[model samples]
Target: MANPDFEDLVETFEFLDDWEDRYRHVIDMGKAMPPLEEALKVPATKVDGCASQVWLVPKIADNVFTFRGESDAMIVRGLIAVLSALYNDQPVSDVMKIDAAAELGRLGLNDHLSAQRSNGLRAMVERIRETAAAAA
Candidate 1:
């Protein structure tokens, strides 16, 4: 499952004039994510450090990692979607190469997010990187 969404998002973000519109687009991307089954929602998948409740589930097959995530707040959920595009459906080597912090900066999202949200976002990226490292 190779997701092509990240490049599209980057292109769209480049096209957008302001952060507000980009934020809206990010939210829309989250809204478009399919709802996870109740069975998959569990304590083990939960992502900590977020003001809002968030869950992330990672799966690996044939050396490719994919993720499923959910969050209580719309914005947080969108952030999860953004993370999915950034991290999911990739080889362990590729995932290991990503500097999640710098990549978020490239997206111009770090400056706009609240401090709490920023910490939460960083936590999420750390979790993904850890998962990738384990699988790698």
Candidate 2:
């Protein structure tokens, strides 16, 4: 099952008629996220394989998983927001069980994103899964 917040995002994507509008909505979602602390953007948090600079900081509390991330590019930042919705506040077990590729595909992102972006997204998902597995 997807996060309730992610389900809301899917609903919003469905409401938008055009890709341009949906793209803007994604950017708006990124704008709505709080900026990650500069100190937290260190090497350990940095996600490799992305064309733009990206960092993800994960936190697990009592078996619930959560993360915050940032990217140098706006679109990438928006992508991070989308990932946050997909994975945040989930139980560690549930986090590992999520099919991120399928969930993102529901938004038609797989068809629209560039190859580089797709790879980067995959990298982020891998990192999240690894973190969750470690916690579990």
Candidate 3:
């Protein structure tokens, strides 16, 4: 099941008629995200396989999974926001159960994103899953 926040995003995407409008919406979401502190941008949090610089800092409490992420590219940052909506505040076990590709597919991201961006998104999802799995 998708998070309510993510579902809301999906609804918004459905309302938008064109890819350009959806793209702008995603960029706006990225612009709204709080920037991660420079201190948290260390090698430990840096995600590999991304064309742009990216970092994800996990904050697990009482088995709940949450993370804050940042990226140099606007689209990538938006992607982080989407992932946050999809996975944050969920139980660690539930995080592992999420079908990320299917959820993201609802946004038609795969059809629009460049190959490199798609790979980077997958890398981000993998990193999230790995972090959740370790915590579980």
Candidate 4:
């Protein structure tokens, strides 16, 4: 599936016209994520501070960095999908350089999230960056 751009997410939010619809869209996006491989499932790959169980794995292929993530909760899986849309298939440096919070704000996601969820999202991003840095 094609990754959604920041503008695409924003436009989706605008088109939805309600938080419920937006949430459903997010869940749908999460449903699209490929299942996390059994080998990649480990405590070390798990993201901290999230309300849901989230795992992230980064790999380099053909010189491009790609991330794979999973969450037991549908909403958190959707959150991973959003992050994947922005960071997957980019170089490690590019992924680290991204200002996820600001980007989410521009996508109208930051404003809608609860404080805990926002913090969890930030933690997820940080974990991804740390993984990328290690890989680099």
In terms of lDDT, the best-performing candidate is: 3
Better of 3 and 4 by lDDT: 3
Each prediction's TM-score versus the true structure: 0.93, 0.98, 0.98, 0.87
Q: Model 4 off-target regions past 4 Å?
A: 1-4
Once superposed on the true structure, which residue ranges of model 1 sit more than 4 Å away at CA? Answer: 1-4
RMSD per candidate (Å) reads 2.1, 0.6, 0.6, 2.7
lDDT of 4 by residue, 12-77 (tens): 878897888998999999999899988888998888899888899878877577888998989889
Single out the weakest 10-residue window by summed lDDT for candidate 4.
1-10
**Candidate 2's C-alpha lDDT?**
0.94
Q: How many residue pairs clash in each candidate?
A: 0, 0, 0, 0
lDDT of 3: 0.95
Model 1: per-residue lDDT, tens digit, 2-104?
2477877788899999999999988998898887778888988888898999889899999988899988789988999999988887887788787777767
Model 2 per-residue lDDT tens digits across residues 42-130: 99999999989999999999999999999988888999999999999899999988999999998999988999999999999999999
Task: Order the candidates by TM-score, highest first.
Answer: 3, 2, 1, 4
Error of 3 at 16 (Å): 0.6
Native-to-model Cα distance after best TM-score fit, residue 89 in candidate 1, in Å: 1.5
- Preferred candidate (lDDT higher): 1 or 2: 2
Model 4 Cα displacement at 96 (Å)? 1.9
